[model samples]
Target: MHAKADQRIRVTLTLNGRERSGYAEPRTQLCDFLRHELGATGTHVGCEHGVCGACTVRVDGRASRSCLMLAVQAEGRRLDTVESLAGEEGLSDLQQAFRRHHALQCGFCTAGILMSCEEFLSRVADPSEALVRDMLSGHLCRCTGYTGMVQAVLEVARSRRLATGPDSQQENNDV
Candidate 1:
């Protein structure tokens, strides 16, 4: 009898603050690896061509398209999906802001939008409407006109500033 060979490659990475190790095909997309393998389904897979940005996630604090990246590429890196935004207490401030501003309609694009907004807000504490629009341009939301999404992010920014004061400004500047 012929011996079977292992075709999957070993991939190890930190996902949502937890170290995860798994075997995946070298060509497996990170989105599939996260959802199918690790079961992090919050990272939605929409266009798959990197145009829709619905598979957006944070890799080492930078926004990235999970569908456009391979699972092996995330080796030794820190990855954060939409699920990480919420803690044990409840939804995150950004999530709350999204709800308060009615950012989501059908909710198909909420995960990616939130991830992108989180990245943008981390960099610009108080971004202008135009900036917010530009930053979110990559994401496609068929439900809302994106005005609500922008407003939601802005609301979070305002709240951060009001609650943290100048420290928030300094933190945003540092990014």
Candidate 2:
């Protein structure tokens, strides 16, 4: 149902390490809220039916399709968009790998692909090529044929695994 002015709900969430709050209609999609209200445009809305994975984002440290979630449902949750990965020094490790491997072409689907890979790499540090392909199965990319994308994610995961051994298996959940 559409929320009236008085019925508009308040949604507070932590985004990119910063606390942010916004008002939303009861039926407002999380994808719309992020792009329009929160200015986190990096989370793209592709098919809007959650098939393309273009609206992927990390909600409470897990990859989710923003298009399939309602804004009000995200209250009290921590959201991390693609914009959260950047730093003053330069791009994040995943982004760097994507660049080095030429993983992206038009870049429309790059954000979602990277986000999915982020969540995957967090849990699996030493993934195989088959596993990487399986991880990317949910995403659809017409350009680059996904070869570069898989390679980029693999590179990041391998390096991170080496840096953090069994004694220090810290997950990269600091999005």
Candidate 3:
């Protein structure tokens, strides 16, 4: 039999610091491949049209909507999802902030929000409430009324700033 390309395409990428490969149809969304193929269910699938932000993930250090991208598009890229948020120490700083603030209700949108916040916090060590809101505009959370989320993100940012030292400019800027 002659070797020929089939409908399935092999995709290889770095997932949560680990190398992984999976085959998928060219039309398969990255969100689907992550969940069904790789078992990374932390990447939720909400609006397939990329409106709800539930499928948000970090591709190559930037926030991206997995549903909007095909699985093949993720080839050779580093992808970060909500699954990588936790460590041996337990909940990450952002997750701890969310838990302490009770920022989630149904929890459907928590993963995407956390991923977005993680990427934002990594880039912006100090963020004002306005800045946080602007950063979170893409995410849509029906639960917690958004106040708790804002508070949680602000707390994380403040704690990060405090960790830098007592003289951090972001100190006393608590939301």
- Which portions of model 3 miss their true places by more than 4 Å? 1-6, 166-175
Q: Estimate the lDDT of model 1.
A: 0.87
**Candidates by lDDT, descending order:** 2, 3, 1
TM-score of 3: 0.90
TM-score of 2: 0.92
Segments in model 2 whose C-alpha atoms lie over 4 Å from true places: 1-6, 171-175
Pick out the ten consecutive residues of candidate 3 with the lowest summed lDDT: 166-175
Candidate with top lDDT is 2
Q: Estimate each model's TM-score.
A: 0.92, 0.92, 0.90
lDDT of 1 by residue, 1-175 (tens): 2222446877899999999988788778999999999988998899899999999999998899999998888989999999999999999999998888788988988898888888888888778999999999998998889888888888888888788787547344413
lDDT of each: 0.87, 0.88, 0.87
**Candidate 3, 1-175: lDDT as tens digits:** 2223458888899999999999888789999999999999988999899888989999987888999999988999999999899999999988988988889999998889898888888777778899999988898888788888899998988788778875655422322
On lDDT, the stronger of 2 and 3 is 2
On TM-score, who's better, 1 or 3?
Answer: 1
